[model samples]
Structures are given as C-alpha cells and as structure tokens.
Target: MTLTFDGTVLVPVADPDDGERTAAALAPLLTDRSTAVLVNVVEKAGGAPDKASVEQREEYAEEIFERARGPLEATDAAVETEIRYGTDVVDEIFAEARDRDVDAVVFTAREGSRFAELLTGSVARRLVKEAAVPVVALPHGDD
Candidate 1:
C-alpha cells in the first residue's frame, strides 16, 4: 500500500559525517508530533559501481540508517527508508519528498551549504522555490 501519513516528514541527510547529530537535533523538534522518514541520497554520479562496491556501499548506508533511526523510534515512532540516486542534491531531495508523499522536509546543512546560502540568500533556494511541501533548513554549526 502507498503510505499515507498523518505526520510524516522528510529529512535529507547529505553528510555521512553529521547524519547522527542531524537526526538527534530533529528528534525533539518532532518527538511529540510526528514520525520521520529518513532518506539518504546515494547520489547517482552516472558512473556504474561493480557489484561488490555496490554491496559495500549499501551495507555502510544500512549501518547509518540504524544509527539515525533511533531517536525517531523512541516515541513509538516509525520511519520509511529510501535510497535514491540523483545528480543534484537538492533535486534528489525534493524528488524523494514528492515520491514519499511527505508533508514537510527538514534538511541539515554543514558550514559549506550554509555559507552558500549566506552568499546567495536562500538556505536551499531550489526547495524554497519549488518543493511540494514546506521546507525547513537546519544549519549545523562548524566545529
């Protein structure tokens, strides 16, 4: 069955480095309210990976998901996992949100994407311009 959500939100995790903390920050923001569907963009670079490489990457991603899935599950919450491949990060994220029928998207950005926004003005200009649901950009602090 196609998942219908009373409280499903999409969180686009770009950095493998900060996925854990990003998910942690989002938990309290959502805990009493809704369930979170975590998405990790594999990023199709248009280059093919051999079967072994593909398996290794998939294994790594699964480990990441298990770590990220915790905070959401604490409140008897549920999550939908999706692995999508796309060229542009924002485009891929928006596509996932649309595909999942999510209500909102929460994105965490490192110092770099944040600086890009500071220079350009929109934290995520594309999503702000054209996402199907509301977009929330959570900026990560620089270490």
Candidate 2:
C-alpha cells in the first residue's frame, strides 16, 4: 500500500517530549500538501470535578501546541493546534481523525507497567486497533 500523509494528519501529544519526537518522526511522511493538527486531550472525570479549571487546562494545551508546532512550522506542512476535553482519550482522538479526514495519526510509543496499562489502558494500542486511519507509533526508549 502506498502510504501518504498528504492530507490532514493528527499528532496526539501525550508526554512533554512527545511533541518533538512525533514531529521528527512525521517529517519523512509529510509533504507540501500535508496539514498537521497537533492535538492534546485533557482527560476529564466521568462525574467528579476537575482539579484544574477549563481555562487553566486550555492555557496549558496552548503551550503544548506551541512547542509541538515549532518543527512543523519550518517545514511545508500546514500546522493547527487543538485542545479536547473528554473522558475517553482514544475516542476523542479517533473522532478528530475521522471528522478531519486525517491521512494518518502519529504518536510516540509509551512503555508502561501492566498495572498502569490495566488502569488507564494503552492509548496507542487501542488507537492502532480501532482507528480507521493509519497509526504511526514511534518507539521510545526507557527514560
């Protein structure tokens, strides 16, 4: 299959360093026709109140987008930043990718303990399994 990142691409930012990592990983896949959307989801509880206010979360999200957009700005890819609030992270990502007609979803692979995986679930794994679009996961070292 011919892989193309010519249309809108979704890059989900999770960790602090994930922005830089995903940017570097996506460079080769992108072309002048590519438009990348840097996304960060703020996981809200089902019924419990959030520790931080919406404005606070939005402010933080903007900072993340700024950092993530830096590398893409230098390239030919058009860059857009977004903040989403949701209870299910995977669903939010898939929804954005489908709604935007994303050509690919790029993210960094995170290694977590079994307990952690059981509790929060693996976003990368779930996305790869459920996402209709291509999911590119860049392997990460233990840091």
Name the regions of candidate 2 deviating beyond 4 angstroms: 1-4, 140-143
Which residue runs does candidate 1 get wrong by more than 4 Å? 1-6, 31-33, 47-52, 113-125, 139-143
In angstroms, the error of model 1 at 60 is 2.3
- Point to the candidate with the largest lDDT: 2
Give the C-alpha miss distance for residue 115 in model 1, angstroms.
Answer: 8.1
What's the lDDT for residue 26 in model 1? 70
Per-residue lDDT for 4-91 in model 2, tens only? Answer: 5888888999755777667766766678999989999999988999888999888888777777776676788788887888999999
Could you tally the backbone clashes for each prediction?
Answer: 0, 0
